[model samples]
Target: MPEKTTAENIFGSIVETLAESGSKQKSVSFFGEEKSNPVASQFNRLFGRQKPVYNLLGGGKSADVLLWRNKKVSASFLTGATAIWVLFEWLEYHCLTLVFFALVLGMLAQFIWSNASGLFSSGRSQTKVPRLVLPEEIFVNIAITISAEVNRALSFLQDVASGGNIKQLLVVLASLWAAAVLGSWFSFLTVLYVGIVAAHTLPVFYERYEDQVDSFVYKVLQQIQDNYRKLDDGVLSKIPKGKLKGKKFE
Candidate 1:
């Protein structure tokens, strides 16, 4: 036989795997019932018969809207839209330049203060002026950080896929797409700075107003869960299972 190319071999293997799985399903049906998945069963017990994600994605919106009806999706859509509008309408070229210039002035002021107060001269025979961070080092560090983040994301997706929950996968995919759409409207540095600032400030604010914030968040989540429970009982419980197309539903 002529040797198969890499693509041909991969295609052949996929076809073979499908054939084997179909045969196994048939055999199980003829001989005995296939074993049930305990984990899937547990998942069903927790969120089955109900919309896997009922409250948040659903309310006052048609289910036909697909992923757009989600709370986070709406939040992100509005945030992105507002950001773009501000960038195009209110913000000017000089505004952006001045923003960067302000940072430069702040650093210059800090340098002057430190030198005047003998901070840079404390131990050295002569005061040494600090140089700007090298562009190459900055780019290399960013590349390394991005690579690590991508690997971590891939590993997380692999673990979730292994769980075999279609609903979970859909949620993850929807969230990622929404985040990417939002990210497209803003620079990575802007997002990073906002995230960093939020990380620094939000904790202190929460700590200061712990009880009130906790109570409010608890009430909102409680309301959402209650709505989910109601919707599940009203509609989702009545839907019957059907065989999935293109494969034997196992």
Candidate 2:
């Protein structure tokens, strides 16, 4: 009986040890998922992106359109853009010619409808045709918005030019160089259409695969930073910088 009781006690202790180890593993995995990598946290803070991509993009109807929250509206916009691009690029249609043709068609339709109604309504009152007058407020609002954006862009450029941020200056220079290269490759209209297409497509794709993109971007940024550091160490640090004496105020 003593031997049997000792064996039972040993088995119970072994089971308890296994249960404790299993619980520890479960706790460790739960906490591991909850905790973010310290390096990733540092990089995220450095990148100054605390909000989600959608929220950073104004988080309204514009965000919804870009992210394709409403498929019908998004598809309609893409279709309209594609049609315009096809007309201008493929059909080689001039803006003024298209405008005049549209006006002529409208006038013809109105003339036929007005005269045909009179001919068919010999014993009845003729139905009134509605006039197609565009609202002045739409044009005014569009002009105002464009002006504001232009002013803001001018202000931002001025700040970047006057500011002492070498990284930002380099980024602006690189972007301008890229734009120049792209301009050499494609016409302005083609570039604009491409930009519109990219704006419609890239945002939705990025939103769908945000985590993978973020991970890839983080890796790329790290590599770029390391290369920049090496360049600075090898060349930039060796460059002679003149020391300026502060003016004395008596």
Residue ranges of candidate 2 with Cα displaced over 4 Å: 1-46, 228-250
Q: Could you tell me the lDDT of residue 211 within candidate 1?
A: 36
Candidate 1: list runs displaced more than 4 Å.
1-146, 165-167, 184-193, 239-250
Alpha-carbon lDDT, every model: 0.58, 0.76
Give the CA lDDT, 0 to 100, for residue 5 in model 1: 46
Q: Write the per-residue lDDT of candidate 1 for residues 6-83, one digit (tens) a residue.
A: 335545655665566556555544565664344544433321234333243353543312234465654565467557
> Candidate 2, residues 101-207: lDDT per residue as tens digits?
99999999999998899889986877698898899999999999999999999999889989989899889989999999999998788899898899889978766
**Worst 10-residue stretch by lDDT in candidate 1?**
45-54
Error of 1 at 203 (Å): 2.4
Q: Number of clashing residue pairs in every model?
A: 0, 0
| Candidate 2 collision pairs | none
